[model samples]
Target: DQQVKQNSPSLSVQEGRISILNCDYTNSMFDYFLWYKKYPAEGPTFLISISSIKDKNEDGRFTVFLNKSAKHLSLHIVPSQPGDSAVYFCAAQFGGNFGNEKLTFGTGTRLTIIP
Candidate 1:
């Protein structure tokens, strides 16, 4: 069963505008992460994230918000730039242990920033 889902397969945003990417999960035990995949061969790089307990987490131009009641999370990139264009993946992790956790990933959403 797919615990994490990104309903929108792609999103387009104008440069210097805000880009919001959404994610949903069925598993309540999950702690979510937003990953950026710039190329097909390389592994996805960790972006911003929100813990299961926190409602929001911000880092520079990126922010992640989590809503436990709705089982949803979102990543917002303010003033989106061309370099921000990539395939983004939402991932949910279970288990608190560092090495023993299991991560379930969504299908991924392609974000395009128009200049």
Candidate 2:
């Protein structure tokens, strides 16, 4: 069962606060992980990614941590802004399997930033 799961359907945070989103997966073969942010009626934009080899990866305001042993991952956004409000998708790719590198996405989490 190659399934990526986001338990929470939504989250809300005040501006300038921290926002945390969680994800889980059941597939053992997944090697590459990615987080994507999507705005209303728009395609998802890549935020951050971590390979199974690494435990964490960080960008300017975004960070992603992977726990391979637990088959879990999370995304953190600091100083959350109103502009940061959108849907977040957790995706995983199976590296070794050809054509299996396609991203398997979670149901998605909608994050809202309150001004």
Candidate 3:
């Protein structure tokens, strides 16, 4: 899990609206990126992931987009629901010769689903 800096500490969204969270990094050597959702006392639950070779990855209501040129990544939750409220984390690592031996996490984003 690769963690750097998360500019926005918290976000609020209507229960039925969309939630968009973004993360930025300075490193450009990573080959894979993953997103995790964390509840109060439970461990983070893996949400989605994308490889450097792909610009976007989607699963159900979650979608992750990567822009290598900008060294930026963003997560999109469509028709956000109250159950989606949680702390979201982003992790990245290299995959080939070095393997996924290293994982760094950036600061987390708090997504709030307003009612």
C-alpha TM-score for every candidate? 0.91, 0.95, 0.92
Tens digits of per-residue lDDT for model 1, 1-115: 8889999999999999999999999988675555555556778888876778789999999988888999988989998999998999988887577874666889999999999
* Ranking of models by lDDT: 2, 3, 1
The sequence of per-residue lDDT tens digits that candidate 2 reaches over residues 1-115 is 6399999999999999999999999987889999999998999998899999999899999999999889999999998999999999999998985778678999999999999
**Which parts of model 2 have CA positions greater than 4 angstroms off?**
none
For model 2, the run of ten residues with the poorest summed lDDT: 94-103
The digit string of per-residue lDDT tens for model 3 on 6-111 reads 6788999998888999988777878888888999999988889899999999898899999999899999999899999999988887888855667688789899
* TM-score comparison, 2 vs 3, better candidate: 2
User: Which order, best to worst by TM-score?
Assistant: 2, 3, 1
State the displacement of the C-alpha of residue 53, model 1, in Å, after optimal TM-score superposition.
0.9
Q: After superposition, how far is residue 88 of candidate 1 from its true place, in Å?
A: 0.3
Pairs of residues clashing in candidate 1: none
Give the RMSD in angstroms, all C-alphas superposed, for model 2. 1.2
Model 1's alpha-carbon lDDT is: 0.85
Weakest 10 consecutive residues of candidate 1 by summed lDDT: 31-40
Clashing pairs in 2: none
